[model samples]
Target: MFFTRKAFPVQFNEHLPLNTLIENIVFTVFDTETTGFQVASTDRLIEVAAVTVKGCQVQSSDTFRLYVNPERQISQEITELTTITNEQVAGAPFALEAIEQFFDFVQRNETSCLVGHYVAFDVLVLKNELKRSKFHLKKLQHIDTLDLIGFLAPSFDMRDLEKYAQAFGTRIYPRHQALGDALTTAYLFVELLGHLKDRGYSTWGDLLQVTNSPARHLSF
Candidate 1:
């Protein structure tokens, strides 16, 4: 499928009030499945999904999921790992169109922040897709659940998403598939926020300190 290039509305993450309570922020917890991890050159995005969270709750009715046609063959190893066969994405929209829709969903959800398991990688995946179409990701206000976990439990070292979910006792969904992982991550994100609140980090600024801290960086 071909998509004509068009401008997408800015996410405006910097405009949100830092004084707002963390619970009051609307977070769009999202995940992506890609052709591979080398997003800058060869790997392309295959699927993206997101769930909304407000007041530390997953808003079930507000969700987004899309499979993207990568215009390339799906490697057998990836299909085995993700269960996303080439046939599944044959009729799907291409990366640019699918991403535009994803951005539209974010706008419609009134998201104040974006959350993900390993958010920097996912952000890079999206940026590469946009760059392919001569578009730029101007700014993204995002939080990594991975970083939050580091800040909250510096002694805990497991970096796998399901392991962290199991350790935190959050809901576990089917692994690898975009929406299922997104749902799992969303629940885990909320749980992490609860722990942060217990430590008196209850405001947007406070949460930012934890996520933005250089010490919170995890190798995973």
Candidate 2:
């Protein structure tokens, strides 16, 4: 039987000390593939994937990927972009159950923060899904790689992930696949942190100072 959101009693996240070393913090860099961008109402998650970054390293062995059965016909356009077939998710776990497994993965890794490119949208997608079950997510600590890129290059206009990865000389991965994008973002995230460190942002507090401005960080 599927459990309600509250039935999962794992502490998958924590508010770390401000002075915590950046190397000591575990970051869950994640991505979601959805039916579309209208997450607040119609769009639903088709896939969710994350990779763990610890001590300035991407732990390739530590990864999580889940295919969520949206229970609705996926549009042909979305299927083309994400290459996710109705058949693939037909027998997959529903949103709540898949998310529970995701939380379990996060709990096992003891993640301190979540990272994504334009992460607010993905968070919203998750929020709306939980709201369907009358559940809600607590305020989460999240960082956007897009914001980091903006910080590094304020005049850069292209907001595309692949573009940023290319410009930054980071590893490029298969587009639209959830896990592949997560891995790409993981490498990009570590590369961005290296740049931040060069600019004297090495501690959790230092990182927060730069990223905590209004419209900089997303709280769920």
Cα lDDT tens digits, model 2, 84-103, are 99999999999988888887
lDDT tens readout by residue for model 1, 1-220: 8655544445644465778898778888899998898989999999999999988899877889999999998899999989999999999999989988987888887787788987778888887888788776655678889889989998888889999999999999989989999999999998999999999888888998888845222111
How many angstroms is residue 200 displaced in model 2 relative to the true structure, after the best TM-score fit?
1.3
Error of 1 at 175 (Å): 0.8
Q: Model 2 misses residue 71 by how many Å? A: 0.9
lDDT of 2 at 170: 94
Query: lDDT of all predictions, in order shown?
Result: 0.85, 0.84
